[model samples]
Target: MNTRSTSRFSRAALPLGIAAVMTLSACGGGSSSGESSGSDTDTSAFSINLDDCEDPASATEPITDTFDIGYSAPLSGPVAGAVELATAGYDARLAAANEAGGIDGVMIEVNYKDDAFAPDKAKANGTEFIQNDGVDALATFGTGALSAMVDDQNAACVPMLYPSSSTADFADIEAFPWTTTILPLATNEAKFLVNLIQERYPDGVSVGVAENPTASGKVQGDAFQEVAKEMDLPIDAVVSDGDPVAAATELKAEGVEVVYHGGVTGTCAAFDSARGRIGYEPELVLKPSNCVNAVEYIAAGNAADGIELGAFGKDPNASENEGDEGVAMYKEQMDAAGVPAEIQGNAVAVSGWTQADLVVNTLEQAAASEEGLTRLGVMMAARDQDYASPMLINGIKWYSTPELLTGIDGFRPIKWVAADEEFVPAGEIISIRP
Candidate 1:
């Protein structure tokens, strides 16, 4: 979110300016209730029995060979640090898998390209990866970029595995069967935040939602509003994409106690700056999927202190997670990628590793299938999985099914302890699904 700070990913050469815009219409409406769980009978594309893979009778012979996995993200430009860290997770875990003799003796070779966080470039990279590179599956980041290519990826039938986008529509299995978003849905995140307010601020809370002018941003703000209304929280203030200082001033005047940011990383930092300038401090919460790059918030000096976030994974700065295997894998990968020691464990990096872990795990499942490995088989393997990775909270698992595409249903609420310089879990992991 902080423009000045550079994570390991920004070390690459500056790229030429290219831009593209995308919008998601299917994701605007928030879910009516938070009860989580998923349906259906589409098994035409997959040759192997989907049920058999759930608990295969005998391990199928996996093709012991090298495989290509495509990766696309903004490797340059303003948000490069977070985007790069996401892919760095991919690189780290893949390296670990390879060192461990790969998934079922098959090596994963990630073919990466810099999209500059531009939608057009992402589409180009995706096309090349699917058509020319001949990758079995693809991994990607960014909501706008992924939204732009849903039709194309679905047409190509190449599984788009574990993209970093948190847009709800990316997980629409019926609409785009070939892709799966690993992050929690934006609407679900809004509900969880509202639930947090109801549980923690039970003594009548006044809330404000900071939103960007874009359609996706509006959808996020609307979601929070819907949930806040359902939970009976007082909505006293609202602001759109404009001067952060003005927005902060108005919210403070209204005595707002909590601010739910429905914008991107820059918008979050801007609000932090404004709050610092106006001395109007409130509980600042950003969309968990995008807020993982807390390094951006921390870069705002002391103004970024005490920010709260919801996550399916541990914060890189959380000392309680020092002994975590996922944390260790993250560090090893960052060091392997030559990331500076200070920049290692932010949200982006943690997410990268988690997503890569999902991909490799599914690949292993697909390889063990009696029908052997194929793109559709790999995609089908991701359905109805209850995956427990190193980064998830101890008891929670990333669960999925044919009917529900959102992989994870719960998030741990964590607060940034500026004094201690680490994120401490504020509450237990809350499950929204059944």
Candidate 2:
């Protein structure tokens, strides 16, 4: 089983005052502006100090005379292992690009910061990246961190691509022009779960949601409720912050047939601990982030039996992905990085690669200018671009539509078959209605 450890990108003790001042200066007198025109026009008419990381001159010099991207994620905290896998994936993609001569003779320079999945640290890192590093865009992971920096991301006009968040709020392009999500929103996953439950237990099955009290948790819980209502399924209970054993026992007492979990590993541990005490393990439906790999759940042994999950991508261990192109590439990269095969289902890695692809594709579409890359130029180029590559998941096409800024929809339903130790696809890919 893979260990759950802290991330490497732990919070820094630096004061944020300097970063705040730099952020203001980067935004051109702190005024919001509309999207730029999609022409080859030189939008660099106005200039701001692009240096602050080291000496002012070092800042002006492009990290590699090409595009520079900054990434923030929990590389050290409780979810460190997960974040590390994601970083590895991004590194693998960059390695491949560098070997191939990079994007149009310009190498992608990735500056990484560890947030430990903390919101304040994420904000501080975002400020630092925007102000000091002067990155072309911000790429990150974790729902809590991304949610906290929504305002700052929008204000700066910096294109934030593929932060590993699947919340519906991040999908709103009108509100968050610069923000785009790589994973399908929790609402879409919830809807797919509801449909599966209806098909499996059609006699109005009893459903329950075990969620955290955070904004992301509430959104997932609400999505579950909405889907249940639409499908006319009876929701037995919605538990928050209670004892997992006690809650599961109570739900079992109420004859709850299905349980939907919207929390993280700790919550999974809690639920697993309570399984024996409750005397029954209801069908478990977990959110994507919580169900990326089987190690955690498999550690629970019989407790995780009959557990089902909705995923936006394929699990690396699944038989369906065996010998596939994307999975093969992923395995090669992991081997080169010396990452254990057991922990290969790191969704963050896939997300990181996707983000890198998006950046490269966008840069490919934009015209080279002495003024360099503009926000509008990159965005407009990304709007119509598509990648015809194989995804880790079989039978699931990974791309974005015009309705959503990020070219990704929801995922196919997958069942955790402990007997085979793989996540078997439940059915065909389901389209998410925006």
Candidate 3:
């Protein structure tokens, strides 16, 4: 069933560190499925009361056959180049899974759309997918757009699963139980960065963040600000987008030692190159995971050298993985699918593969559960997920709990090797310590 169509897709940072298990505010609200409608069962660790909102698709008929999943992303926008590579990785994994006989013999079907990264468009696409298409599960991109439509998703009682902006509101399980994130949450990234910096420069170090106006960027900068305050590291500057060169100049004048970055794609190379142009070599310069792409460095030129990015385990460049079994499977499948060599080996592409791993594993559990292929069943499997993701690095495993919703306990730090134009492990996995 090739049901592809057209369409679209807030996190505040939580307390710092992987050890800070969130005591969600939405705990014990009501029914996790629309089948029970208004039943307020406090038994499950995560739940959503259908009575709070309306969407008949929540009780979507049991899928004893093909399981339809809807996926949406910014297929037509400024970051479309990066988006394309990510999509390639996702599609490749789906192909391999389908070839392997799929979940419980039920093949997965995907309906696709290009949201252009806009909120209104994403909201419209989501409504169509949940209500009209009657898809059993959903996955999407665009943080601001998705955050605006949480009510619509939660009301339908469908599992809005997989990769997207890991916003604060989405992870508040008590409130949005149907939503599960695959990307690195800002809070986790903040904790890891702060810890790594402090661990390396014990005495102290002045830090600065290159900020942007996007929802993801705002939240990223906010998270860094929050963690820095808690750790007592003075921030030299919180420079916004539009003038990376001038921003670099300002940060240098402020005596900023690390030109760390926060924001979506393009921002990394921009700021890193800006510093390079003026020969302002801060002790260290790094980027958040979302911007971990070597091709983007073309604009940043030589400045991209020495830039490190926080990864959620998987490094896109296969060379860095060498003998990893999971990564080997990924490369074999991606190669068989004929995905472009460069695209198949990119960080964004592996992120897509990782998202597929989350969904495939969740579907397997749902098919075996008593609930069986229903929206709530998927949610249950995702909530209790305790497994390894094929694409992660440094033995990172995927897990979920009442405290951790994303299944990611820490961020794997990978650095760019400018000479080889690839990203490799720069240090040990800096875990989120209590």
Candidate 4:
């Protein structure tokens, strides 16, 4: 877990603020586990049938005639570049869908708000999208902001689809009924990192966590703590701060041999900065959100020779397999959009595209609902729906239930190879324990 950066984007304007506030006020809105051998009746043995669209056999009917989708993210924050990439994927998908004749001729409209990675701001914008703009669902990014608005969205019965938060608390389907995530939960990432440590350094592992004070950070940090205690591994130090350099220094003093970062790209930059100041560097483990776009981090002069990270989708930077439709589509759209090819594979864009697809699918389902297109109705339709978007990590499936919409069970580890300046796959997918 690493500290969150204090840097703010210079381009965000007051108009964006007013729009977010207005959106929130207007709608009045207000809005995994291991495989197990079990009996057929066992809950763990159940799986959704993706081929089942609806009871009326509307699968062949165009879904576009029915509804619209909307989203809000940090389009103007420190993470904007990544956000833009994700949105581009969404845009391309939307265009492709439209070109193919939208779901039943119901055109999907995507409205986005720039929360700038601020939780309070996201909450406000979320409320506006639900209440004022009349968006049937929301696709959001960042953990802190989504957590901030969970209560409102849940109470309002607005389906918050494909939020980018991977925190365990958010994965508790029973607690937050209206929200779902697209990536493997952060708790899983922590578990995978710990498992890797145990296998590689069986003697004794000195673990360090750099965490932010936000809800997501705390959940991931707690997971690491629990696993270390369970395994009886020596916990070097768990540091919480907004400053990465200072946290790194403290971890170094603690003789930390393995570091787990809970923050995003900025935290990686901080770790890089700290590495420069001190002579020592530890094996780094990053959260899914932090690991995407390693080239930029490396180019910034961060030595990522021994870094490993958990990933939720196919790494764009990784070598592509022949006829990989998702990767091919991503590259085509990114190039056409004039986005630099280097940043195509980053997690931010993949997340954005995945979330957008969720929105699109939810809207398609909602249109077929007999209850019409109200937020609650749309959410109900989305509940328990199953679909595999092109952007999910390989061999990972996206699912949702009435109580919990995101899958918590999947994640893979990736190790950064300095020679290629890319993250190479490390191991098979593993589960995150509760």
Candidate 5:
């Protein structure tokens, strides 16, 4: 579900045919003053080399009245599930934003193409969105879909506002200045998870990691291992290749006291089911943020009861949260937008709504920046943000800087109670930054 929308409200605007261009003096993107963390007003933080940027003069000559957004992601493949759910959230947010009056009275439009999770197809789609469709910004769903095309986006100087993966690669604004992510950084999640375990079980618990074999999964799994080692925490076993049951059995045989499955929702669900089938209950089974789902885990099996999760936002689907501000906004907006009633019970769409809101907010901020509504201005505005809303837990602040690329530094710990079919807050929100 989503929140807040009207049917494209109109605002006063300037003459429409002038092309938007980037100048160091206009936006202060060429200077080097705000490299340090949390530089909220650092206009010079996002560097742009015109030569490296794709035909900014021709590709974006005479800015159009409508702000076009294009997405390249797997719409027809196995991995398309999450993207599809996120799309619903994105669409809901876009509709709501347009309803609330799009940036400067200019309407926002979005187009999506099926990349089937292929890097090559994703690259082609990204190029088409720029050279062909003249989209104001580009968005890609997964890491593989964006890997082959992000350089092109940066070369063209187009802002690829939040590519849904958290491999830490997007944090390198030096290489991909036009890219940013609303997703919690994999590195940050790993560090926080390790620290949480260490702080709770001071005597030390045997940790085992179930690493997902995919690129993004490997990145997250590797981060977990690295952080665990840095904290002098030893892993009892590591399993990457095996059936879910086999992996669970192996970890149990190792006498692992805790298991952290750094994978997507489905993988985490499988691991939980596998553990339960054999009655191999560890002290805790920590799953990454991606596993914050209502149906997936519970449907997998009742073993999901004790599964600990890292949450970047409040749970909209939890029944007890019916009166929460974010929850009400999501349910009402989604219902208003005619999204299925079932989606209100799933956190995936809520995650999508959060990401889309980030994009909407970024565009809104960029429109008001000193450089005006140029594409370069969008990147500059996005590079430094202090986003606060009822969408996140009360004390958690989602911000970004040239130095601190990770947007959400902390996550509130959550526990899934299959019996109640909801996520319960376990403890205080943990911030790894300090």
Candidate 6:
């Protein structure tokens, strides 16, 4: 739909450019502290060499000839259905990269473990990856799992790439230089939703927030409130629990005009059921992707009628994007891998595939550099690189630098049309910053 626009109202609400660069300095001495010194010199291209980095690399250590990375994801939990699809996407891309001879003929290996969506298990898996596997980096998922092991990963100086989380804190380069999250932060997504709210409900509307009753859910819900406050959006209801129907009922009773779900598919579906049962229809928004899928739709039936997905990627089932090369490639790989046609179109799977592609590109860039490919070099490659996934909406190029840690800055709001069983772009892609 190519309707992407810079959010005007929220830009005034949040920090911009250099002023935005200082938000995480308290954590790990942001390497861009020097560039933010109000210099007249052109500092946009400044490279970060933070003095407080936890595990400084030796200048003389030659880059390793081969690389081994670890992947920690929940493969046997309630989320396993989506996690397996994501892993399938990852495996598909990794197979393609390896078949192409792998970054200057330096073979790449991956170690995988199922943490069962348990934080304690995830920590144990991270320990094994660090101590026994000696992986150069890791790809992880689950908010709880990542939260439990991020500090451990940082202490080991093992860069964790693209965990399936949108928590703004994960992008704090100063505190967690070894960590990089792939999803757009919830705060940023809030800006787009706010713009939509202002447009559709011009007179101003009260918003309600629903969370999953977990530590991470509370963190995300609080961040949404903070951003909503910044934008002067009134929040009339805040519900946190496992039963989304009850939460939705509470919001409905409050006469809220819009509901922002800061939870997963189950909760979102529950809200839909509650709305349908009570005949209360409000503008609903789910964030950072993976909130709903085919299974959820089938379960909720017409309950999912007008649900909106806030995401940074292309709608895999969008009819307009049928010929997209990346989507085509994804289908072909899934077919080759024997993935069910139904699950192959899953957005979570596509995101996993995209994440793997990004990692491969970073490794390729690092391997090509004269500095060669070491753990530090991999981190350097990931920092500030501008890359576009063919599968992303409008071909949006995701960017990150030492000073700016958020990998994505915007999202394309999509509405689920249950009749057609597809998600279509509802508006032009909206950016949080200019």
Clashes of 2: 11
- Go through the candidates in order and give each one's C-alpha lDDT: 0.65, 0.59, 0.69, 0.58, 0.71, 0.67
Q: Count the backbone clashes (under 3 Å) in each candidate.
A: 4, 11, 11, 34, 5, 6
lDDT of 5 by residue, 209-316 (tens): 998776667777888898888879898899972378888889989999888898764345767778888988888888888878676787766788788877867667
Candidate 6's C-alpha lDDT? 0.67
> Across residues 1-434, which tens digit of lDDT does each residue of candidate 6 receive?
01111111110122122221111111011111011111122223433343333434421134444566777777777677777767777777766776778777665667778888889999999999877766778877867889989988887778798888878878777678778888777677667766677778878777888887765576668777898888888888898747766877798889887887776533346667766787778766555355746567656778777778666776566687789776777677667767777777887777877787777777776665544566555676677456666666664656676566657656777888788777777777766533
User: TM-score order of candidates, best first?
Assistant: 5, 3, 6, 1, 2, 4
TM-score of each: 0.80, 0.77, 0.86, 0.76, 0.87, 0.84
Q: After superposing candidate 2, which stretches have Cα over 4 Å from the reference?
A: 1-64, 265-269, 283-286, 345-352, 365-373, 385-389, 401-403
Cα TM-score of candidate 6: 0.84
Off by over 4 Å in 5: 1-41, 58-62, 317-323
Q: Over all chains combined, what TM-score does candidate 2 have? A: 0.77
Worst 10 residues of 6 by lDDT: 25-34
C-alpha displacement of 340 in model 1, angstroms?
A: 4.0
RMSD of each: 10.6, 8.9, 8.5, 10.7, 5.5, 10.4
- Find the 10 residues in a row with the least total lDDT in model 4: 23-32
Estimate, for each residue in 1-434, the C-alpha lDDT of model 1 and write its tens digit. 11111111111221222111111111111111111121222333223332222212211222345666777777787567667566666677777777878766667777677887777888998888766665666766667778776677776667788776667767667667677887677778888888877777778677888886544566677778877787778788889746778887888888888888776643456677777888988865545446646666666657778777786876655668778765665677668766666656666667777787777777766655433455545666676366666677666677776667656768887776666666677778888766
**Candidate 2 vs 5: which has more TM-score:** 5
Best by TM-score: 5
Over 44-101, each residue of candidate 3 has an lDDT whose tens digit, in order, gives 5554454444543344235655677777677778667777777788878877888888
lDDT of 4 at 278: 76
TM-score of 3: 0.86
Task: Please give the TM-score that candidate 4 achieves against the real structure.
Answer: 0.76
lDDT of 2 by residue, 1-434 (tens): 12222122211233334232121111111001111222222222322222222222222222235466667777778667656656676676666665667655666677778887788998998888777766767877767889887777667767686677767887775566567766667766777788877888877667777776655567677888887788787788888735777666777777766788776533354575576555766755555444554556666666666566765555566565677766677667667756666555655456555556555555554434321245544444444333433443444433443345434544666666667655666667676534
Model with the higher TM-score, candidate 5 or 6? 5
Cα deviation of 369, candidate 6, in Å: 1.7
